[model samples]
Target: MKNSVFFVLVNILLCACGASANAPSEAEVFSSAHTTPNVLMIVIDDLGWSDVGYNQTTDLLETPNIDALAQQSLSFDNAYAGAANCAPSRAVLMSGQYGPRHGVYTVSPSARGNAKARKLIPIKNQRGLKTQVITMGEALKSAGYATGTFGKWHLGADPDKQGFDKNVAGSHQGMTFHYFSPYNLPNIKDGPKGEYLTDRLTTEVINWIKTPKDSPFFAYLPYYTVHTPLQAPEQVIEKYRKKGIKGEDAKYAAMVELMDTNVGRILTMLQAEGLSDDTLVIFTSDNGGYRTTSFPTPIRAGKGSYYEGGLRVPLLISWPGKIKPGLDHTPVINADFYPTLLTLGKAEQPNQALDGVDLTDLLLNQQAINSRDLFWHFPVYLQAHHARTDQGQDPLFRTRPGSAIRSGDWKLIQYFENNEFELYNLANDLAENNNLASQKPNKVAELKAKLKAWQQQTGADIPTELNPEYDADINQKMIDKILAKKTHH
Candidate 1:
């Protein structure tokens, strides 16, 4: 015997290298490196970043199924919105933390306009979302997944107390005074007699991704049909009034083409429950859109102005074959979707402080991002929604007690009541109409000491007294009658 055939061929080559190191690597079973993937997340309210058609900036906003899910998805041409409106931008996208680590900077009375036009006296606004902040639906339901959520849980009171095992209408009521039916929301129910509250929350999440689960969910829709009294469904408002689009911009482009046919029926029920390449989805928008029925054109003002049309919008993400479709501009926000869905759901990450940045290698290695410095702080006072077609910061407030910042391609802002700042350069002004803060005073003291050391590392709330019913001649006669009706439009 040749040494018993060399010990049985070295135990069959060590059990085939331990079964190829215990398999599972097609990008680690669709990323998170060992079987963890499924996180829908839609959002869409006050949509803009040029009302989606993959940003051809509006060939009259058709949004063919969110432009076919932004052409397979990776999209992110400078996304942003973690406070520019809608309940502190859904409480900084469910507390990855911002707005001074959760004071919720707006959508409650943080002195919103006319205490003789508020001069300072704000920092109070924490209307909800502070159950000790660990929610990206409770860290993806403690990482085994299977969560729910449906639509618009404007940061409080029953998103099943912030983790969402299932909370269909999702309350704290941000808007749904009537999308149809006595959608008298809260844990939702009534449907049948004139159904259609975004087609019954997209058939109740495609019957909860066709039930019968085995861990891996976190759905979260968040659509309140393109927000506000702009009804639709009269054959999709006569197909946007036959695309000649009329009034209220054809009922908000027929409620964004009926919420893009309920997002192509949950992308055909995640490809009939095969869970579309182990799912990842995303898509976005919680702010910016509602500047008199439609206008994010040239990014000037909308939603509740921190500008760049209320912090731009549309984000996409997809994850079909482990994230790779294309187009990435970087400037992300929305508290970077809770450490980018807890690093794609391999989860477990919340013992506080996560100001956002694990965009999962900017959505799986298209990575080049680098140039950071985002910050937005809104100390309060929002007002001006349609001040003669809102291009605010003038027509009597659309963000007054401020704080901005951008940093690479420089932005600046400031303004906690005329301690003023302004600067611009968003790579040749995306209509911030050039100020360059007195021609860049050392780039405005280097972005005002990096926006004052990020408002002293996010303790932020500095509105300094004053507002003893401050009038200043009725805020300069309503900012000179809305700058003479926005200079005759």
Candidate 2:
């Protein structure tokens, strides 16, 4: 009997050992079938939905390279920037959180425009991202990836401290003082005399990619092209001039073409390096185009306003054979890229809560995510660039302190100053010409509740105190002067 018991114990031990040997390790479970994929994220400053050739919205500007990329990418038709301007939009992309969470509603002091024009005291803005916030660079670096940021890093003074292995010219400066060499920007030594900023940055990225490294890389190329100080190579400028595009229009066109050419260069480098198939390339804009230079028509307003033109931007994601090339109509925001990238890199989530959903299944298997409301809270004021042509609610300012919510086809904008609401069904009115707030009271109530709840949940500060300097008469005079100038022009 004792011998029989010994044999049974031996058999049980052998079975347990076999099971343990066959189990997959933790790393194996997290890894892909092949080595990890490299990520190349390109963010253009103030690039509009209608700017690219794929959209076919304008014939004045040419973007052959961007158009070609669109052909090989899963272009999103309803993609939005996290905010209507540069700093906040970039903050959202980096931290994967909404404006309320980071307190970066707009650039610098939120109380923009003349003191008399502002009705309420706007919420103060956070200049740069806090060190405590874990950026995409930090997350990807933790996952054993070599990270680099090549151009504009407007979030902070030093991207190196924010988790980047290499930061070329990233700084707190929003716009470049000079587009050519003797650029005089931080972290970038001046190149050859008369070297174009866009071209130089592209070369820097290509050189970085060529450097030998064991782990996969995350290359963030945020070009400061097509922003302000609308400058371009004289030759490119003359090319547009020859096409009969004159004035700032010609210069803007030249800048767009230059940016597109640099994009082509990057694509060529990726192909030459044999990294095309192994890399995931995402091209998008920080925000919508500026109204004074570029026209974001058929979708009212531009840049600072919360209209479709202000928030909407071109988004293209390409992973060669991994993701099928086609148009995706799903409404997505730039904040979504954070979780999506972390999942692709097989990285652990940060301790802080992320507002975006993981889009792995949607990208790889074409499985659509469940419908949910997207929110935007901007408790700040942005002065108008061109009050006459800006297509905003009013001519005085582009946007007042407000919060907006989009649920399915319905969208509602709530103004903090007057407690007014503007509701529109985006499916029917993409231009947002019609305000259906009074027409649909129930819909307004439904969306308002959700917006309020979101504000409460995120601890979004609303501007309530009336501005002490606000003058009704002065505000009217300013409006009249703007109108008269428009008429004179």
lDDT of 1 at 374: 87
| CA lDDT for candidate 2 | 0.89
- For each candidate, what TM-score against the reference? 0.34, 0.92
What is the lDDT for 167 in model 2?
93
Clash count of each predicted structure: 0, 0
On residues 408-464, what C-alpha lDDT tens digit does candidate 2 reach at each position? 989999999889999999998999999999999999999999999999999999989
Which candidate has the top score in TM-score?
2
Give the alpha-carbon lDDT of every model.
Answer: 0.81, 0.89
